[model samples]
Target: YMHRPAFVALLVVLIIGGTSVGTSAKKAYNYRMRERDVGKSDIVWNNDEYVLLKNGDINKAYKKIEDELGIKALKISVVPLEMKYDRLEIREGIATIKFLFNGQLLCFIQAKNDIASSNNVVSDRKVNSEIYNIWLDKQITIERNKLSDDQIEYSMYLSINGAYYYLYGIMEEKEFEDIVSELRF
Candidate 1:
């Protein structure tokens, strides 16, 4: 009789443990599927002057920024601003998203402005290095400055009708260039 009770208890414990494991596995699988669906979606904002393009995983993007910068106060918020040409009203200021790829830190900035006004804002004066071409034959002016004995900062500026973008980070030179090449800007 005692053996029978012990056996029943073991079976009950096994059943409960199996149910818990299965539930956890299912939850993980669902989370991955959700992430995949988000990655396949496109987020865009279009107007007469320009279009802003972003991935559907905006929350994930913000999370990346928080993780990379170790900042907890950053929240997704819109700022109102006035543009120079056409008196274009900007409802958003800038979006800063960071990601880590192949052990490199990449920061992406997305902003929108009138094409006419954006043209006037492009200047190579701040860039410390020679200009190079990237996506769509667009010129990328780079500036690198030493921040400390072991660290360096890089800034890349590019303007397109879709958006006015800036990427700045402290990383390896080759990795920075690689990330710039992948930008959709």
Candidate 2:
């Protein structure tokens, strides 16, 4: 009869663990919904897969990065106005993030939040942003590689706020120039 109590205890433990996992998952879902709603923009989240956005409201994505890094994150000023996406995903790395706008691959941004981990590559091309960002390295440099007929990949090295940021993306020439030139705080 004493063995029966041990079996009951085991069952209780399993039940409790399952309930705890369910509760935490629910909490995460609720929190994501709240944050999405608070944006008050046209960002639509059907599930955890991808966030479909017509207006391209990226507040949640950039805000999350900033909150985690404790530093301001970069935002794209010039965006494709005709974009209509249906899925959303945030692929994360050690200190990197690649986000899809609802369904399409937008860009890849890696924030080297560590000062010592900054990229040491010498500036290949002079980068001048009339707009000054405090977090930007004064001697920021950039390089470009043509990936395909239509896709041009650009990598911009930024040393800022005692950290470094590597911005990488493949876009049209005009789009890339507009993004790099129009970057703001």
How well does each candidate superpose onto the true structure, as a TM-score? 0.42, 0.48
Give each model's whole-structure lDDT: 0.50, 0.53
Residue 140 displacement in candidate 2 (angstroms): 5.2
What C-alpha lDDT, on a 0 to 100 scale, does residue 176 get in candidate 1? 62
Q: Tell me how far the alpha carbon of residue 120 in candidate 2 is from the true structure, in angstroms, after superposition.
A: 6.9
Candidate 2 per-residue lDDT, tens place, 105-183, comes to 5443535455445345553444423333343434334567655574546667665575455665555545555666555
TM-score of candidate 1 relative to the true fold: 0.42
lDDT for model 1: 0.50
lDDT of 1 by residue, 1-185 (tens): 69999999999999999999999877654521122234656333233112122333444555554444333312223211211111111223445565443444545565645435433334322455644444446556677867657667777876555555666766666656655555541
> Worst 10-residue stretch by lDDT in candidate 2?
85-94
Residue 31, candidate 2: Cα error in Å is 34
Clashing pairs in 1: none
